[model samples]
Target: MFAEIITIGDEILIGQIIDTNSAFIAQELNKIGVSVYQISSVQDDRAHILKALREAESRSDIVIVTGGLGPTKDDITKHTLCEYFGDTLVENHEVLLHVEEIFKKYISSPISELNRQQAWVLSRAEVLHNEYGTAPGMWIQRNGKVVVSLPGVPFEMKHLITTKVVPRIIEGFKRPFIVHKTMITYGMGESAIAEILEPVEVRLPSEVKLAYLPSLGSVRLRLTGKGPDKDQLNALVQSEANKIKALLGNLIYGEDGGEPIEELVANLLIQKNMTLGTAESFTGGRIAQKITSIPGASAYFKGSVVSYATQTKIEVLKVPQALIEQYSVVSAQVAEAMASNLRALLKTDFAIATTGNAGPTKGDADVEVGTVYIAIASPKRVIVEKYLMGSQRDRVVQKSVNKAFELLQKEILKL
Candidate 1:
């Protein structure tokens, strides 16, 4: 079955409010084997709403609409929907009571005519009750097509769609079976990963589709399959994923769209009952911030010191001034000193340190722009990595943090 989503609001068109409802609806519909053909954003006008509704209904088996249902005079979705369906708006006593009860529980005020008008429903539409808000959802049908109108508020719309709308649509449509698996890869750029897996990509089954979604530091390879049964599709996707993993190996960090790299590292550390700390230079305190975002991080995360200045690296982190003078601040020797210094200072099981020129300009005569050196100091070993990142300062900082986490993970694996 095919579906179309219409998000009705001038706010969306003007970029005042993001239309997250369509994305939610699309995901839900996709899981249920219903294809979302198109998504539209229309202004809060009666004529435009009607035109969009007609166009969506003509092309889709299911039409989902959001917004324009409010207590104010500008809200005209219910009236326009009534006109389109050749019906009239009539007061729904149950919806009015719900509105009054909500108001009494919260505002403790008398009911107004505008609120009553807002509760009014189209005569031919099925009322989808809203538990979280005042506006009741409407399900209207015309010319063998389904049109579901939901509240624009994200929470209220989500509840109605999940509890009420999705169930009804599932009952009416013969949905096919669909499954999706996502692989989260790191330590490789999108182009590099693609180039490495070019042969596998070329031989992919027609039923399975692959999409690369790249973010700041990693790429998520999502494989989606649609078929008539569950077991076959699952086997097909699992086989494809195994092939991709064998080709990519350690470059594929976590699978099935797992949490951020920090979470991945935290899980590994927690599993090993290991403690960790950091000494930072160019990335400030971002690495520590990412580590602490994981719950129960204190179980393994020891501490971090932002030694951006050479003086801080020497004084606070106890990096030898001779080392900085001999090898410069953004050098492997300084990075190793910072790591070993923090490991001893915090008395943790492990420590990670970064010293880098994350900049749009040169930091040292020998070290060009975006020169980064990351060091991991464990009880048994000390490993350092060198990378000449791109010219973008923020990208250099972010990629440095990710690489530091990757190094931490690698050291943990060695242990």
Candidate 2:
């Protein structure tokens, strides 16, 4: 089945707010084996929204609309949908009770007439109750197509879709099985990876497709397969993934499902029953923050020292003051020293350190704006690498952090 998502908000059109609702809706729809034909964002104006609705309905079997569902004056989705479906507004007692209960339990202020108006839904549509908010969702079927209007608020829309809309769609429609496999690779650019995977891509089955998604210093290779038999589709995807794994080997660090390099490194540390720490300079505490973002990180992650200043590197991390004068702060020597000292200070089996000049201008050390040095100090030896990233400060920092985790993961694998 094919679906279309329409996000209605002047804020999105004007770039004041991002349309995250559409992305979430698309992912959920894809999980149910529904292909997203098009995603659109329209202004809150009634005419624009009506035009988008008509266009989406013309091409898609399922049209999901979000936003402009509040009780405020600018909220015109319910009224415009009523016009589209040729129905009138009628009071729903169940919705009214839900709104009343929400107001009585959550809000201390007395409910106004506008809040009460949330109970009035389209006469011909099925009222999908929203337990999270006052705005109720509408499920309208015209001819053979389905139109589901959800609240613009993300949580409310997500709750309704997961609890009501998806179940109903599953019961009403039969969809094919879709499987996706993603491999995370670092220390290589997209162009290089694509060149290496050209033969593999050409040999892929007709049911499977390959896509490369790159960010900063890493690239993600995603393999998607579609078929009627779930087991066969999964096996095909796995077979293809194994082929790519044989080609890439250690360059591929982890898989998809939010397991990035930091998570991969954390899991390796936990599995080996070893602890880790970090000493960061130019990357700011990003390396440490990524490590701690994983749940139960304290079991393997000891702590981090953000020795951003030269004096802090010397005083806190115990890097020699003379070494800073010798090789400057943004050199590989200082990165190695920082990592080794941090490992000793924190009493961890392994440590990762980063020092770089991430800026629009050259640093006091006379290095280029994007010059970075990352080091991983393991129990046996210390490995250091230098990189000349782009001039963008955020990009340089991100690349440095990613490279640090990648290098750390590589060293941990040897253990």
Candidate 3:
């Protein structure tokens, strides 16, 4: 089954708040074998909301509206839903009791009239109790399609969907089984990878499909299969995945959804019982930040030195001043020295370093914009490589960081 998601808020349109609810709801729906048809963000204006709802119902079997369910005046989703359903707003005693208890126990204040109005819901709707908030979720059935109204608060919306919406969907409709498998590959652009996988794609079955999700320096290949038989569908997708893996080989780093590059590196370090350190020039401490973002990193991560300036590289990472004079701070020689010194100073078995000229105007070096050098210091040797990332400053820094990890991963595997 397919569903459409509408996020009703002026805040989302004005960029005051991000519309994360659509993503969360879509993922949840996908898990239950329901696909999202379209997602829209409309202002809190009544005409816009009504138009969006009408359009959504025309295209999808289920329409989920989030936000605009608050008790305040700008919150009109509840009233709009009632008008659409040709129903009236009525006080629900059970909802009122829950709201009162929440206030008395948690909020510790007398409920205002505005807060009490949260108990008034669509007369034709089935109330979805909100254990965490004042606004109750509404479920209405019209002409065999489902319309659900939920609070915009992420935590409360998540609770209502998990506890109420999903169960009702399963109980009411028959859904096909959907299976997804993702594999990560680095060092190759999407066009290059696609050229190799074109033959494999041509052979994929009708029910199974391949999608490429690309990022800075990597691409994630996801195989999604849908059918009545879960095991058969899973096996079909896995069989196709094996074909892709056979063609890609070691180019594929990790698989499934949790396979972030940093997490993969962290796991490998833990497996080998090795410690890591980083020295940074253009990337700042971002490499260390990505590594430490994973839990249990303290066990394998030694430390980092953000040698962002020529003096800092000389003073902190102990890169020789004479070398900076010979080859600028953004050179491969400086990057290699930074890595090698960081490995010895931090007493880590592995070290990664980044030095680059990411520039609108060159700060220290006269090199062109996007010139980057990434270095890795292993137990046996130190290696550095250069690349021209792009003209964009942020892109250059991020691509440098990704390339650093790629170089580090290759070195780790050598050990």
Candidate 4:
């Protein structure tokens, strides 16, 4: 089955509030084997809402509407739904009780007539109780079609839909089994990854769909399977995913929505009973921040020193002053020195250090912009890698940080 989600809000259209409702609804619908065909956003106007509702009903088996069901005046979804379903406003004692109870929990005042009227929506819809807020969710079934209207507040909508609406839809509809798998990849651009997997993409069955979702430093490769039998569908997708994995190999870091690179590195270190420290210059303390964002990182993460200046690199990380003078701060020699010095200073099992000119302007006139050096200090040796990234300061910094973590991840794997 298919559904269309219509979010009615001027805030969404004007970009004041993000339309997170659509993504939540789509994922829920997909989980129950229902596909979301289209999503639309309209302002709080009766004519526009009615038009969108009509179009949605014609195209989809179900139309899920949210927003504009507030007690306040710009909320017109309830009234429009009433007109569409050929019903007049009627006072619901149960909904009024819910609304009044919600108010009493917050304030010590009695409910007003306006609050009572807010609970009284068209009786045609199956009044779905809103446990989180004053507004009630509505469900209407007519002419072999279903339309569900929910409150715009995310928590309230979540409670009503998960507890009531989704169960009803699952019972009412018969849908094919759907299976999906995702592969996460890094160190390759989207176009390059796509080109590498083009042959695999072309040979997939008609029931299978492949989607590429590219992000800041990685691409999520999603493979969706739709068939009558759930097991058969899953097996088919898994087989194809294995083929993609074989082609991509270790370049495919983790799979199916893995943790961020920093978290992955931290977990690996913890698993191996290793401790890590960092000495960062161009990246500031961003490397440490990313690593510490994961819980339980304190156990494996020794510490980090933001040696942004040459003096700090020498004094804090204890990078040799002679190395800095000879090769400059943005050189591989300084990066290796920083890693080795921090490794000894912090007394950690492993250390990662970054030294680079992350810049719109060059750190040294002759060094050029975006010249990055990453060093991973292992027990045996310190491995250093050089990169000349783009000219943009932020992009250069981000890519350099990601690459440094990736290199550290490789070093951990070796141990």
Candidate 5:
């Protein structure tokens, strides 16, 4: 089954507030095997809302409307819905009790007439009680299609959908099983990865679809399948995933939900019973931040030193001042020295180091901007690589972090 979402608010169109309700509703619908046909945002004007509702009802099996359901005059969704259903307003005693209960719990003063009017709902609709707010949800059926009206507040809308709407949809409709699998890849652009997986993409089954979602330095390949038999669809998705894996091999770092490369490195360190540390220059502790972001990181992560200045690198990390003079601070030699020093100081089995000029202008060392050198120090040996990233500072830093993780993963697998 398919559904359409309509968010009614002038604030959304005017950029006063973001419309996060549509995304939440769409995700919930997908979990229950209902595909979102389209998502739209309409102004608070009654005529615009009516047009949107008519358009949605003609194409969707179910229509969900949110916003403008409050008791204020600008809140016209309830009245517009009344006109659409060819019905009139009537007071519901059960809803009035719910409203009064909510007021009694939160409001110290007497409830006003405007708040009391929240109990008046359309006579033709079935009321869906809202435990979180005074405005109750409504469910209406016309010509065998379903229309649900909900409050604009995010928490209240979520509660109503989770408690009342989802169960009803599951009991009322027969839906196909849907599955999604994602694979994460780094060190390659989207078009290159697409070219490499062209053969596998062309041979995919009709029910399975492939999408390449790319970020700064990585691409996420998602495979979505829909079918009546859950096991068969899962097997089909796995088979296609295996084909792509065979073609890509270690280039595919991780899978499903597109886990970051730092998580992969952390898992590898834990499995091997090893510890890790970092000595950073240009990245400015981002590598350490990413590592510590994973829960229980202290088990395998030692610590990091952000020796940004040359004197700090010499005094703290003990990189030789002579070495910095011989080769520039952004040189591969300095990166290797930083890594080796970090591993020795922290007593870790492995360490990652980065040194570079991440900026819009060239630094005092006479090196061009985006000149980065990353090194990995393993128990057996130290390896370093040089890269020329873009001129933008943030992009350069992000790319450096991604490359550092990729290189560390490669070295970990080698051991």
Candidate 6:
């Protein structure tokens, strides 16, 4: 089925509030096999909303309206919807009681007439109760088309869509099953991976499709298959995934919504009972931040030292001043020293260190922009590699962190 989303608010156009409701609604609709035909935002004006509603009703099986369902005079969605459907507003006793309870339990103010106005819903529409807020959602239908009205507040809209809207849609319509499997591969660009998987792509069945989603230094291969039979569709996708994995091998790290590199590294560290630390320079402790985001990281993570300045590296990480003098601070020698010292200082089995010059202009280091040296100190030895990431400062920092994890993962496997 096809659906259209209309987000009503002048605040969206003025950039006062972001229209996050459409994205979330579209995602939920897609999960139920409803394709979003278009998404639009309109001002609080009545004429504009009526025009949008007319256009959507002509082309879409379902129309979802969010926003402007408040007690203030500017809120016009409920009234405009009543006009479109040729209905009138009436007081719903159930909704009136709900509003009164909300004000009594949480809101200290008494129920004024304006607050009581929230209980007035469309006379002909099915009221979707709002357990979390005063604005109750509405579901109206005419000529076999559905129009669902939801509150613009993100949490309230989400609650209605998940609890009230999704169940009704599922029971009311038959939707095809959609299954997606994603493979995350590091150290490879999108074109390279696509070229390697060309044969697999060429042979994919009509119901199955492949997509390449790339970011910075990695590519994600997503395989989506759609059909009526859920089990048959899943089996077909898994068979194709097996074939792709056979070709990609270790280049394909994780699958079926591929886990992040940090989570993968965390699992390996915990399984092997190894501890880790980091000494970050220009990379800005992002590596440590990513590692610690995983749950149970404290079991294997010791600590980190964000040694950004030359003085901090020399005094805190205890890198020798003569070493920074001999080679610029952004050297492999200094990176190695930082890693080895952090491993010893934190008493961890493994340590990662990074020093780089990522800039719009040359910073303290004499090296060119995007010149990065990354070192991983394992129990066996310290290994360091140098690379020239892109010139953009943020891109260089992100790429450095990714490459650091890749190197550490490889060394951890060796141990």
lDDT of all predictions, in order shown? 0.89, 0.91, 0.91, 0.87, 0.92, 0.92
TM-score of each: 0.93, 0.93, 0.96, 0.94, 0.93, 0.93
Model 4 lDDT-worst window of ten: 357-366
List the pairs of residues colliding in candidate 1. none
Number of backbone collisions per candidate, in order?
A: 0, 0, 0, 0, 0, 0
Question: Candidate 3, residues 271-377: lDDT per residue as tens digits?
Answer: 99999999988898999999988878899999998888889898888889999989988898998999999999999999999999888888899899899999999
Q: For model 4, which pairs clash?
A: none
User: Of the pair 2 and 3, which is ahead by TM-score?
Assistant: 3
Poorest stretch of ten by lDDT in candidate 6: 250-259
Query: How does candidate 6 score on lDDT?
Result: 0.92
In model 2, which residue pairs have backbone atoms overlapping below 3 Å? none
What is the Cα-based TM-score of model 1?
0.93
Q: After superposition, how far is residue 192 of candidate 1 from its true place, in Å?
A: 1.9
* Residues 157-269, model 2: lDDT tens digits: 99998999899889998899889999989989999988888889999999999999999988999999998999999999999999999988878878888777788788899
lDDT of 5 by residue, 1-415 (tens): 7899999999999999999999999989988889999999999998999999999999998999999989899999999998888899999999898888888988898888888999989998999999889999999987888999999999999999999998988988899888899998988889998999999999999999999998777888999999899999999999999999999888898986656789888889999999999999999999999999999999999999999988889999999999999998889899999999999999999999999999876664679898999999999999999999889999999999999999999999999
RMSD of 6: 2.0
Summarize candidate 4's per-residue lDDT along 180-267 as a digit string, tens digits.
Answer: 8988887888999989899899999898999999875678899999988998898899999988998899888877656777888988
Clash count, candidate 1: 0
Model 1 stretches with alpha carbons more than 4 Å out: 257-259, 360-369, 391-393
Q: Cα lDDT of model 2 overall? A: 0.91
